[model samples]
Target: MSETGRLILLGAPLGNPADASARFREVLAAADVVAAEDTRRLTRLARDLDVSVPGRIVSYFEGNEERRTPELVDVLAAGYTVALVTDGGMPSVSDPGYRLVRAALDAGLPVTAAPGPSAVTTALALSGLPCDRFCFEGFLPRTPGGRRSRLSALAAEERTLVFFEAPHRITGALADLAAAFGADRPAALCRELTKTYEEVVRRPLGELAEWAAAGAPRGEITLVVAGASATPAQRPDDDALRAAVAEREAAGLSRRDAITEVAAGYGLRRREVYGLVHEG
Candidate 1:
């Protein structure tokens, strides 16, 4: 493959055009073809940067990504420097460019990137959480049960975690996170990142949950949650566990259901809860 026929992933400005890198402009103007998640947004961004792209511009987004990747791959293989950009942030990082990039790589085509602003890093930096070791969770499942199960699975994740949530679900998501990761966990809610009205609210997860419940904030949101601290060596006393189980059971939960609920509440394994219940 010719060196010129490479796939380049470009990270666009998250909210500020000034954050666009010099390399980003040079590559965008040099590509043989530009595939963007939103063609209109790409055009607008190009106008904003005053960069004229003399290449074919096409739409590639979540809905059409699977169907369009093969075509884009063909363009890359045909000696076209295919430049991929998302509406904002880094392409393929919770965006629509992963499939095309993967296909290009597998086909032995050269691939590269022009790094620019990213909401993930921006929010993490503003979060005041431990960013040294962190994980980007992208987005949570929309359904209540699926979201709950997903959060439950991440209960033991030790790295600080980041997530993008819509404004409307902010409160409920925070509540679910509190239930999964313990209310005392520290977190930050970053809104309208890099924009004129940007706001960052840092607090314990429990307090965030309460604040969200009062009113949903406007603008795009990014949440950074601190990981679990060292769990206490000693488990709750047998009487305490029994009382929790009994309380749930009295609230119409079956013995089995109450055991599960109490176990999750205390971050204990279900088997351990069962053993304790039986022992008492």
Candidate 2:
């Protein structure tokens, strides 16, 4: 209600028009300007809702977001309500509208949201995985090396992880996830949520990878993976610790280095491992 203007972020439906809220339609239809990731898709959505968007619709996507943010801010500064929406889900969540929102706030313009459905929460809830705490990793890098590096970094993350992936890359993504997290890691693949022919496959990473490789899935895909298990607090027995050090030593590490590495791995002091390894 500020005199400067308001930037309303509307959460579009994942794939169902019915998911759009009454306030979403009200704000979208009455806004002075609408910044949409895909104007065509927004048009279709408006049509589906039997609503008329009389505002000037402009394209605001990843490719053009940086360039268009200033212009949108100018409109907001002029005291015209601007509704920000993406192809799906909330704006600025791995989607467009982040720049404009930031710009609006910086310019002291009002900003708010009409929250709707989100694939992150939907998939997490339907995944049957622990959702008490979770993290949403919108999408992994498209490149193999980049994806592997990112996955490797997240291998030990303890919170349930959610990710968005393209239909075409699901195979390689699942494979990399399995290799990084562990083949037996439990994961759920939610595809085409809220749409006809929707699918939710819950399985181990290894099996999901194999299934993707066998046949390409064709829809928006959300992956929910169980977090890494916490390392047990119980310390290994002396014999086990000694054997661990010996295994590392056999792998070309010097006794001192092997003991150090083993100790760190087992959360024990170096001297303790050293003593255990050299014990009479």
Candidate 3:
């Protein structure tokens, strides 16, 4: 409520115009400066909505997001309401507009968002996996080496994984995912969500990789992968440990070596095995 300008982040429709929210329209029409990820698409959206942009239009995208941020910030600080719209979904969700929003907040300007469609959440809803806890990975590195390294970092991650991938590169991405996450991990491949050609295919990570290799879809894709199950260490009970000690001792083995064998067999530390054996 400082009569100063407000930085309004608007969520554009991912693929379908009908997905446009009413708040998106109100913000776009009332804004004095509209920063769009793609001006051409913005124009198309206006046409589809039969709404005209009364405010000045400025292009905001990845290539110019950093440099153009200052200009937008200056405009926003001057008490001119600025609206931000990305090519798809919300701004700053693996897209531009985050820098400008940060700049505005730093300048003590008001900032808000009009919640709308998100491919990540939509795909997660359709994934049929455990959605209670999940992680959004966005897009992986373009290069194989970088992708592999990044995937390796998430290999031990227990939360369900969500990622956005292009249609053409999805197959390669799936292959890499399978390699890092394992073959039998359950996964769902969602393509062209909210669009005419929307498709969702759920299967094991390895089989999905093979399916993608054989043929990948041709649209935006969001992949949801199940998290790794907790495999608690299997420690032998007292009886099992004593029997193992008996077997190894009878086989001409020292108690120390027998403890090692039992420890390795039960995936327990040698010290743990020793302690277990000494207790009664």
Candidate 4:
């Protein structure tokens, strides 16, 4: 049990009330002050969970987060348990709650969390992409120019990338992604996660862009994109390719096998290697 005068960050289910954990219910019921991104939604959630919140319910969303942080920290400093809950997922994750958390930390107040469902991790797991290493980019800029600049800067990032996007902007975002990362870059679009109408679309960036342009789905969206290749982008010169093939052939390998080996080593197509060797 956390001591008094501590801040607890609560994680709400993405869309399903059934995803709420037992610990979350306990903490929600115990908090002295419940700062919610959406008070109405929080009320509905508490009703669904059959948990009684014997605490003050206050609005703590984006528009008022700045103004509310100091007040929440003051409450925490006064030996009260304050629980911060966003509309969904954990607070401060492309959502409200960061300011209040930072204020509490700076004031030497205790801060903890009741872990809940996360769209970021959920989408990454279902995307069928590498998850060993990844970077959460939150939401991209809404404007085309700004989004392009951000995407261009991240073009060479070797770790898998995750992002939150709006349904209305998904088409343009995917088009920009294709242009920056290349048409063939693999990606997944997860929609209405943990909800009845859940949908996951996996495709190349260009194809995704086309699909989105055709008709954008309505709901919260999470995107997972494959990383850029770690290998050097520059193709091997003809002489280099020829030399590698010849060296492999001298090591008791057949010409066909040598070409395949050399191509794999240089991250090139076997036909490129063959053409290089036969273009005498």
TM-score for predicted model 4 compared with the true structure: 0.82
Backbone collisions counted per model = 0, 0, 0, 0
> Across residues 1-280, which tens digit of lDDT does each residue of candidate 4 receive?
3345999999999999999999999999998999999999999999999999999999999899888899988888889999999989989999998888888999999999999999999999987667999999999999999999999999999888999999889989999999999876667899999999999887667778998988987899999997886783477678988998899789766686577546544556557778989994
Q: Alpha carbon lDDT of residue 34, candidate 2?
A: 92
C-alpha lDDT of all candidate models, in order: 0.84, 0.86, 0.83, 0.88
Clashes of 4: 0
Residue pairs with clashing backbones, model 2:
none
C-alpha TM-score for every candidate: 0.80, 0.81, 0.80, 0.82
Which window of ten consecutive residues has the lowest lDDT sum in model 2? 260-269
Task: Identify the leading candidate in terms of lDDT.
Answer: 4
Following a full C-alpha superposition, what root-mean-square deviation does model 2 have from the true structure?
11.5
Q: Rank the candidates by lDDT, best first.
A: 4, 2, 1, 3
On the 0 to 100 scale, the lDDT of residue 263 in model 1 is 58
CA lDDT, candidate 2, residue 182: 82
Q: Runs in model 4 with CA error above 4 Å?
A: 1-4, 232-280
Any idea how many clashes model 1 has?
A: 0
